[model samples]
Every structure is written in structure tokens, then in C-alpha cells.
Target: MPAPLLSLTWTDHVTGRQGFLVVDRLVRGVCSGGLRMRPGCTLDEVTGLARGMTMKEALHYDPSARYVPLGGAKGGIDCDPRSPEAYGVLVRYLRAMRPYVEHYWTTGEDLGLNQDLVDKAAREAGLVSTIQAVHPLLEDETEARARLADAFAVRVDGLGLDELVGGCGVAEAVLAALDRAGHAHAGARVAVQGLGTMGGATARFLARAGLTVVAVADVRGTIANPAGLDVEALLAARDAHGGVDRAALRPGDRELPGEAWLSTEAEILVPAAVSYAIDEVNQQRITARWIAEAANMPVLPEAENLLAARGVTVLPDVVVNSGTNAWWWWTLFGDIGADPDEAFAHIRRSMRALVERTLGRAAADGTTPRAAAHALVADRLPEIADRFGWYATPRKDAP
Candidate 1:
């Protein structure tokens, strides 16, 4: 069952503004979550996220797992930033939330929001960066996502790969897996879905690493090249918005149904799209020897089990998709604040270590990568919890 709701409150100010924060779960002193701005946001989701943050903190960071109290909390302003009068309403909402702005509920980008916009709201509310005016006790989601995306973009792009950071990391992991299993990247056929930051990154990375990116897709459409798509040409022709312009495409590449990209004949398939994108219904279409998840929960538990039964080696999401966020924290909270280059290096190191170790453990036990990761977390959480006094320590009997 989902965790129980730990705390909930709603506030209606004299200014006719509705503001509230839900500390759905609290482990210690830390709470982490996203700030959302959209319509019809209810208190339930915020509370749920708050709880998730606590658990996420508990799982992700062993050091803070005890003292951090990293509860998950989310704030939502039931307003659309796209609307003409959205900024004014957001300002009003922020003003009303001044009490929680700088400290209690550190806001970050979620649906219908971005860091720039979050900063706008922060500015109006007189909240500075954690180190600027006041050291923030909690981190915001926008910064986290930006940090991840930034790390992904800089390293992937600088390395001259078309893959987004998401893709590159997965590409690296896939290569690592293959090498361990005695398969090689050169002349490998790869199919990628989503073509978003993560997807594009993966495709580009694979292509450069000597994999034939035979198929790629986006929400708009798909293109297939059985003889290996010219990723560089396609990338060059891609529009500013990140979609390949078909009008500029060469004849070898032809458009296919978006879903068709997921089923193409390739040695590896990277799903960098939404969760549950691949279910039992479409799992049969999977042709890749390996399935790599570069999106959060892209593979359902059932689907994962099914893939495991089929002997299709799988690399779980957390192993591949955490590079960006890792660097973000290292930069913001580490004793040595990171510059851009150092940040990317930090992320790459974490990704390499996590993926390599998880893969090694999984291989030895003949277990799924996801299972190995959970085991890793499970092994670490208790020590953290103990150190933080989440449970009582036993007293020694006097001699």
C-alpha cells in the first residue's frame, strides 16, 4: 500500500489567496519536493509527493537518511503560467507564501514550470539562493532538474555526441554491459524512443560510439533507416525545437508510426519516454537483446518481470537517469562548490560507479539490475537510519 498521509494543511489568506504546504512524510529535518503551478491542483498530490521525498531521500542519500528528515513536500498554485495574468497571480501566491518561501518549502520546477519561472517567483518573494541571502535548508526541484539537464547537455554536447545526457549515460551503461557480456558497440543496431532530451542524447551517443541508430522517434513521428540512419545528418537537419525536419531529410530515411520506433529491429532499445510506455501489450514487439530504461518507471513492474523471464538483460532507470541530479547536489551542497566542468565530471563519476557496481552485482547473482539496485539501497538505508537514531540504540548492562 502507498504510505499514509502524515501532514496536511490549507491556508486562505485575507488577500483571498489560497496557500498551503503538505509535509506528507518527514524523516528528520530535510524535506525535498517540486513546486508546481497549474490548475486543479489538490492537497492530496502535494502530500503524496512530500511523503515520496522522504522516502526518496531515505533511499538516495545514506548520509542524510538519518538526520536530514528529508520529507517529500510539494506546493501547487492553481494557476497557469501560460495565461496572460499568470505572473500577477503567482506574485500574489508567493507573497502569501513568504513564511514558507525561503526555508520550509523549497520550491523547484515541476509540471508547467521551469527554473527561470521559479526564480521569478523567488525574486518576488525575496528568497535568495541557499548561499546568497540565507542558506536554504531544503533544495528546490527546478535546480535539481536543471542541474541534471545541464550536466547531461554540457558533457554530451561537448563530447560532440547527439545523444542527450540521458542517452549518453545509458549508452555508456549499455556499452559497459555489453563489454562485460563480451558484446561490442561497433556495428551494433540501436533503436531509441522519445527523442526528447534523453532519447536524443541516447541516439547520438550510441551512434558516435559506433552503434547504428537504425530507428528513432518522437511524439511527432518516427524515422527508420535499416542500413543505419545518418545520425549526424539527421541531427544537423533537426529543427531548433529538437525535431528532425522531414522536408530536409534524405530518401533512405522514411517516416513511420511513432510506436513503430519502439519495435524496430535492433540489438538495444532505449525507452527514454514516460512510465509504462512499454507494457505487456507491446512487450512482444520488443526485439532488442537488452532494454535500457532512461526514464523514470518507464517499465512497469510486470513488464520488467516479463523481460527478466525472457532473459532480456535490463538496466533500470535509477542506474541510468541520475547523472544530472547527482551533480546538482554535489555542486550546491558539497564542501567544494562545483563549476560547470567539475559538475559534469562529478555526475559522470557517480553514474559510472553506480552503473558498474550494480551491473557487476546483478551479473554475479543472476538477478535483475533493478533488484540489485534495490538491494544496494536496502543494504545502505539501515546503517543511515541507525546512525540517525531512527530506531533506539540498546543500552549495555553495567558490569
Candidate 2:
């Protein structure tokens, strides 16, 4: 892969925690991704995530749709979000990055961070919005912002629409794969790692779709049961950080090692938490027929190769987790309204089509799904560039 277009590191003046930003590739003078705050985050990790965002944006390109996918960028801060100082570090980091956020990068929530908190910090950092950079692309910025704010306010079963769309996309990918394989969703066991925004919603959707959620791993440990755990109960009892309250566990639930989520007897494993969760060593324990990555880069390259050799299909994160990012643009650009039903319907249709196209190419090219996704992005980038040009020019007509 080529080096990122722009990269910078910022250290909080008070906390001394480091933050990194990488614009992997830019189209139309701006890029889109999210901000994640987690301890031990590194520049390399942020770079990988930015590149994934590039692929994600390209994969969702549709000439007919109103939403034009932007280029990719990401920001990460090396501090645990639960810490009291995390908020201050985020404010200082955003203040330091105010220039880029204003001119080139449009970011939101990712991983350890959420959109509300990011917006709050961005305001404290003297910005109009965390996504203010993309406002220039809007036909009517006021209408677009109102639509997005409304969409963000929409919720289903007490979960925000923004939080559930990505998981909905992942569930659709899983269902698409099952439909192609003639696998019945009824008895398919799914083990999910991470019970946060992505995982909780994914579990809810899958469980509603008739799949058995045999295990869910939070930061604490793995909660398992052979006969499907109560997903709704677990979700309701979940803390803001995504950890389930142990008191909510029903009888017959077993608490296993955190890594047990990998080896649990299940047809599918959804890793929705952290990157590099499955390395070469831990991969040998995964016996699932499919691993859908709800988190970015959860499976490293070598582990993916090993899993592929064993016929374990691994869906790339770019395809599986692209829904959330797509939904934001779809809402803001008027491709879809701030309606929960419309949003869910759009996500399902788009994700299913994307999965089918990606898997079909994988079979034809004799390559992994990740490679197939890369090829698709490679095909679309030039088309986007050809139409939009490499860089956007200054608009004389101002707001």
C-alpha cells in the first residue's frame, strides 16, 4: 500500500497522551472517518484504519445515489476513554487538530469514543461540528445538519439509529452468506466478542433473525450458554461501556476465559471490539465456519491466511462495518431520510448486494474476500477520480 497522504502526531499538553491522524487518500478536498480513544493506540494502527476507511468509501460508491463517498482518514488518541482525564485529553487533542478537522477531516465516533462526546469536545475545541469539514459539500448545510441531527436522535428499542445501522449491516452480511450457503439461520450459533454499540445491536438483530447467540465476550470475560443466551436481557443490562451486568445472567450461563469467545462452538464469530484481537496464535482455536469482522482489522494478515487455509471464511471489515459511515452520508446528503425503517431497509439492501458482489468476485478470482474487496475498491477509485477529479477546486460562490 502507498503511504498515507498526510500524517501527524499530537501530544496532549497536560496529559501527555499521544494522538495520531492519517489521511490515507483524499477525494474532493476532504476525507471521512472517525475518532477513537483507547489506551495503547499507535500511529500504525491509525494508519491501517485510515486505509480501511479508503476501501470502505470506495466500496460504497454509487453514481446514482445522492451520497458521494469521500476519501478516508482517521484519528486516534492513546488514552483509555473510561479515565477521568480522557475527556480533557480529547479536548486538547481536538483543539490541536482543529485546523485539519476544519479543512480536511470529517470524523465521528469509533471504538472507544461516541459521537455525542466527540461533538461536545469539538465544540469545546472551538469547532462548529466534528463533521464541519463536510458541510461545504452539502447542497444546503442547514437542512443537512438538521436531518443528521434528527437521524442521530432516532432510535429502536432504546438504541440509537446511528449505533444500530453498522450492526444491521453486519447482520445482513451474515444472512447473505448463509442464504448463499443454504445454511439455516434457525440453529446457527453465533459467538460475539464485544458487547458495545456494534456487538449489542448485531446480537439483537441476529437473535431476532433466528440465530442462536451462544456466547458474548465483554471486557470482563466470555458469557456462554449452549442453548442461546437471552440477548435482549443482556443488552438491556449493558452498561454504557458495553459490559453486561453479571447479575443479569440467567441460570445455566457459564463464565469462561475472555479468549474463549474464539473457540466457542459456533458457526459464526463476530469480533466487534478491538483490532488485532485474533493473531496467528489465537486463530488456531477458532473453529467457526465464518468470522464476520464488526471491528476494524480484528484479524491480522497471517491469521487470516491460516483461517482461509482451513476453509474458515473471514469477511473483511471494510465491507461488513461500512454501513455506519454510509448511513451518515446517506442521511446528510438526502439519499435517505431520518427514518428508522428507511435506514434499516437501505442498509439491508445495500449490504446484501455488496456481500453478494464481493463473494462472487472472491470465487471468480480465487482470492480471499479481503482481496476481492480491495479489487472492487481499486476498480471504483478511478471512476470516482475521473468524474470528481483528483482534488476539488475552490468554489468562488461562498456560503
Which candidate's TM-score is highest? Answer: 2
- Please write out the lDDT profile of model 2 over residues 1-399, one tens digit for every residue: 789999999987797899999999888888999999999999999999999999999999999999988999999999999999999999999999999999889999999998889889999999999888888888899999999999999979888999899999999999999998999999899999999999998999999999999999999999999999999999999998999999999889999999999999999999999999999999999999999999999999999999999999999999999999999999999999999999999999999999999999999999999999999999999999898877665543454
Clashes of 2: 0
Which stretches of model 1 miss by more than 4 angstroms?
A: 1-28, 33-101, 104-114, 117-167, 232-242, 335-341, 388-399
Note the clash tally of each candidate: 16, 0
What overall lDDT goes with each candidate model? 0.61, 0.94
Which stretches of model 2 miss by more than 4 angstroms? 396-399
TM-score of candidate 2 relative to the true fold: 0.98
**Candidate 1's residue-wise lDDT over 1-399, tens digit each?**
245434444444433434446654433333455566655556665554454444444444635321233444667666555667666666666666666545445556544555556677668767663113113332554554454445434433344221343455677778777777888778988887766556666777678788898888865788898999887676666643357778766788889998897789888888875556788778878878888877555677787788789888778766676543333345445422324445444445556677788888887877898888767766755665665444222322213
TM-score of 1: 0.71
